[model samples]
Target: MRHPSPSSWAVISICIVAIVHLALGFSFGFSVDEAHYALYAQHLAWSYFDHPPLVGWIQWPLIALTTSEGVIRLIPEALWLISVSLVYRITLELHDVIQGRSSGYLTNVLPSGPSCGLMATLAVIAAPLPHVLSIGLLPDTLLTPLSLGLMLMALRWLRKERFSLGDWIITGVLLGLAGLSKYTAVFTVVALLMVFLSAKRKPWINQPGFWLAGIIACVLISPVFYWNWVNDWISFKYQIAHGAGGTWALRRVAAFIGIQIACFGPLMVVGVYFFLKQGWRNHRLTLLALLSFFFVPFTIFAALSGGGSLPHWTTPAWFCLAPFIGIGLAKAWSQQRRRLISSLFIVQIALCLIGFGFVLAGGPPSANLKANPMADLYGWQSAGQKAAELAHANNATGIAVQNWTLGSRAAWYAQPLPVYVLDQRQDQFDLWFGQLPLGANVILLNWSGLSYVPPTGKGAGFESCRLLDSLETRRFGQLLSTFDFSLCTNWRGADLVR
Candidate 1:
């Protein structure tokens, strides 16, 4: 078969990757974090106790457009475009390292340069997590682009051996943006430091640009720390508590590693080896990639210390290593089995489609604890709907839901009714609800657990609130079970309670 030009192959890779992700974005509902972030966006604040504010800020516009699932997903879909472009650029850059720009007929080394790009992009885009996770309004979408941007800039800085003040500013800005998107992004700084400190060429640490970049990153992340201080360090406590839940069973750790391999693909093994091979000779650049991997230790420490670490925490590790790995794969495959490389790309695309289809069909991914049997323990979307119906029957002017996943989804399905989120964590309900006039009909989707029965005394302030309906794990999907259960309200003057 005839070979295509390097540039042509890169284009083909990007198109396939972008198209696959675009489709995946349309197929799935917002995962839990996506829903949470979307709601968080609905009301802008400096930051959430659990995460930085970038996700909410990024998603704010999309949430305003339409409540439609597809509209909210557009942000993630858009990121895929940027991701693909960066992949192509990185691949081309990596190729140039070994096959210097002036080398004649570059075709001799990476004869199928464009095909190589195609393989790399497909490998990434075809992966289920990247596509599925990206589409939802989450931090990853924001982080992915910024991480890639930083990498590109880092490469340029590394190659030039001298970065201007502007270059440092741009690098710091991108890193800061990435940090806001996800805390794991702090690893990028570590990676850069390791590279600069170790690089034999120009000893990058002494340069002013390096310090400028560091200061910029610090400034960008200042808001997150500021919020933490104001909240009495509750965010830190919550994160620590959350991380403690995962036990340090060796099997679990092994399983988590296994999950990453399956999600990221076996090519990662090759990627690792490629780095090790290059690190042996090209020590400086290889160490930069290794530093990214060092983030896994941070994650493990978080897990072991009972600190929170999500599955995607290592995303930057894989992403930063992409360029070096791509070059290695290109070199090795060009000599050994170039034909199979395209086949691998095709398989990834196919897997992406199947994975998305399965999720849409109710075959939930591992990330969605909500889809597990424990969902009722969290909140039932269907139950929320039933609660809404009772509110309608009671002629309630507005229903007060706790304004979480269950509350929000209920509000979403039961539209047109004024729903107030008693976000007690923030003190809104406590401040205004007591002083404000009561609505004719009022229903409170309280979260103090089902045991807290409503007051039945004559002065209980409801003519009579009754248990209209209740929903639980056993009767999850059937709304009928929850429709009739309710806690009767106590009315001041009415004798209904008697």
Candidate 2:
């Protein structure tokens, strides 16, 4: 029996790296955003106000099988890992083709690449993964492959010219599913347009394959249209208002760019640039197709959009750039420079341990970072228990939360007690349980921080409000967050009372 070579070892190591990701999920609590997404599972639907219904639908089964946050997280993390694994697989096939397999049954079956698989595999491992990405249930997590697939599949179809109609349909389905995962995927059409419009490929725009794929994609994404039409197109309008505007916060735009650079790794600056040059130098039109996916989103959402928001909104495009980084670094550097890349990977693994270890413990060890942001995940179980106890003590008929985040936590922890979120923000909680009856006593949890201004909705919106006990969530002698658990008497409409 032969031992695994260094090349194969990288692929094998991915499995171990994946296990580390799964194990860490158990340590953190649901992110503020996660509770909201997880709560989406409670009220199943065809669509949602913030996004398409795919995320809710995806989370529903996993959320049902077990409430364990770690287990719930494993679903999307598995998808992300699968995407990486696919890229690694693609590199292997590409490598075989490039390295001189004149003709063989297996050789013909595999995809070939200009670079070896090891560099691509290692670069993906070294890339920074945000806490929310690793722990939370997010649509972007689901969007990973569809976006990458759209680029990779389209590139292969254009460059190789050996693909059949089935391959074209698969590309369409991936593009459609990408749209289902996130609105950003809509730009894939525009990218493909650039591919068709390319000087070399312009004549092929009249091809039936193009129209065939377009129709299939349209069919797959039609549900989004159906849902929005039923709900007066709120989803469409909401995305526009939420992501785009003339607020003109240059600092926000700058920060977004900086965060992306940090997330991709500073070394990627060299990797991505050289990769692009090589791709253009070799496969010009094919490289442009891959690039359009990255450039269009990054330009629109990060460079142009205003407001300080999630830098990860640009993640899918950045993710598509990974294989390039791997190949770029492989070619640009000498064998000795491998030490630097290895050192970076070691740092990443160390950070995963040290950082998550601190966060899992609910605090940092004598660090200036002060409180751990991951602690937000820490307090939900305790907060839910306290809310449940207070609801029982008040003889409250039901629970009402001021915001969706608190409402989701309440729903998860305070089960069997119908929890209603009476906020202006239109979430499923508000949609499903908006019917809070009149003359019913309700237990309201108002965030102390959000209380800086006058409380509205189920908070100050109540006719008779009595102060109950404030619940303090602490970990390791540090006060994480404080919640005002109030007993509001009489049923005054949250909007009406205010």
How do the predictions measure up, each by TM-score? Answer: 0.74, 0.86
> Which candidate should be chosen as best, given TM-score against the real structure?
2
Per-residue accuracy of model 1 over 259-331 as CA lDDT, tens digit each: 7777777664564564456443433344345445345434554345432245666555556556556665665
Q: For model 2, how does the per-residue alpha-carbon lDDT over 168-204 read when each residue is reduced to its tens digit?
A: 7887788778877888777766776666566463444
Q: Which regions of candidate 2 are displaced past 4 Å?
A: 1-6, 90-115, 199-209, 276-282, 365-371, 435-439, 447-460, 470-479, 495-498
Candidate 1 — which residues are off by over 4 angstroms?
1-6, 20-28, 99-115, 200-208, 274-309, 338-347, 364-389, 392-408, 411-498
Q: Which ten residues in a row have the lowest lDDT in candidate 2?
A: 103-112
lDDT of each: 0.58, 0.67
**Residue 356 shift from truth in candidate 1, angstroms:** 2.0
Question: What number of clashing residue pairs does each candidate have, in the order they appear?
Answer: 24, 7
Query: Considering only N, C-alpha and C atoms within 3 Å, which residue pairs clash in candidate 2?
Result: 29-377, 93-111, 93-112, 94-111, 94-112, 94-113, 95-113
